[model samples]
Target: MPVELKTPPSDDWVPSMDDLPFHRLGGEEEVKALANAFYDAMDADEPALARLHELDAQGRVNAGTRERFGLFLIGWLGGPQHYMERHGHPRLRMRHGHLPVDTGMRDAWLRCMRKALDARGISGGLRRFLDERFANVADFLRNTEG
Candidate 1:
């Protein structure tokens, strides 16, 4: 089962478009576009993303996976917190522990993230911030020495 991120129960909690920096900067469509770009990078790049493709081939990441990923990103980018609302703390390392992620994997993830950010046409500041955040999470997701 996929891990879920949890959030405090608050009936007053209503996600607004302005809640997410990405949305405030771009929009909902832009966010989706960014996600699509990221997925495209993961799909197109072989040398750095072969593992991801293999995972997809193994049925580990399907359409649902993409949707979850996009939802996670939406929340992660300070948006609606939909992921946490529906799912729970994103224990990313623990969840990805089963994957054979290493330095190579981390780099590949970063590369795809960079490509995605570029595709969004976001500001340099946001891109840098995202790069740092992605690096930290990707590093934590690494479960191997190779």
Candidate 2:
């Protein structure tokens, strides 16, 4: 069975986003790579999920969508706040509210992200932290019943 995505308890202390090995993971380039890989994985394997994003003539995620996601990932991973400065706060739920984000869609997203992180060779404690955190967000984004 697939692991479920849920937030961890607040009682335990966890590193802030900026303290999550962003520099150790090679900062901007690596984070951007993760974002690209994420979209690539979704495009290649998660058709249902990919359909929700803006695509180009070739049926690939558009440059603007990819670029925006990359910037969001960069800031989310604690590298830089360029995404915020350029686009304002990431109103994640508000931004995604237009879509019917059911459990299956959420799972598909997590699968793509897992593939991206694995492709990037993200492991150890960092991997665990990322896995848990990503799950939390993915779960939170679900807006429909399965």
Candidate 3:
């Protein structure tokens, strides 16, 4: 005789992994760590981050850049919308409009992001998704020669 398979009970179907909640509160810690890693990579990889460092030196991304980037990442990583709450809409492209973000710059940014993500020990799927999303955002931020 074949046994019948029983269906599991269905509840409200709450999502198991709530990305937003995960990034809120202490979630900002990861963002801060990622920012640190990104900066570290920029400092270490001379050629990759040369242009970015130049821009930073020009005061385009002064000291406040770290704090702002941390806050922004907090929100971007599905944490509390602190960046949006404090700065209103991100207006990413507009904010970066003055910067000369070329293909090389974009690649450098992605490289730093990749290193940071790798350092985070995030799940493979999440890492892949984030990398792709970051690439798209980085590409959108690019406003210079190809």
Task: Identify the leading candidate in terms of TM-score.
Answer: 2
lDDT of each: 0.68, 0.86, 0.69
Which ranges in model 2 have alpha carbons more than 4 Å from their true place? 1-19
The list of candidate 1 runs beyond 4 A from truth reads: 1-20, 47-61
Give the candidates in order of TM-score, highest first.
2, 3, 1
Top candidate (lDDT): 2
lDDT of 3 at 30: 72
Query: Model 2, range 1-146, lDDT digits (tens) per residue?
Result: 99999985343435664455566467888888888999999999998788888899999888899889989988887778999999999999999999999998999999999999999997766777788989999999999999
The TM-score, computed over Cα atoms with residue i paired to residue i, of candidate 2 is 0.85
Each candidate structure's TM-score, on Cα atoms with residue i matched to residue i, is: 0.71, 0.85, 0.72
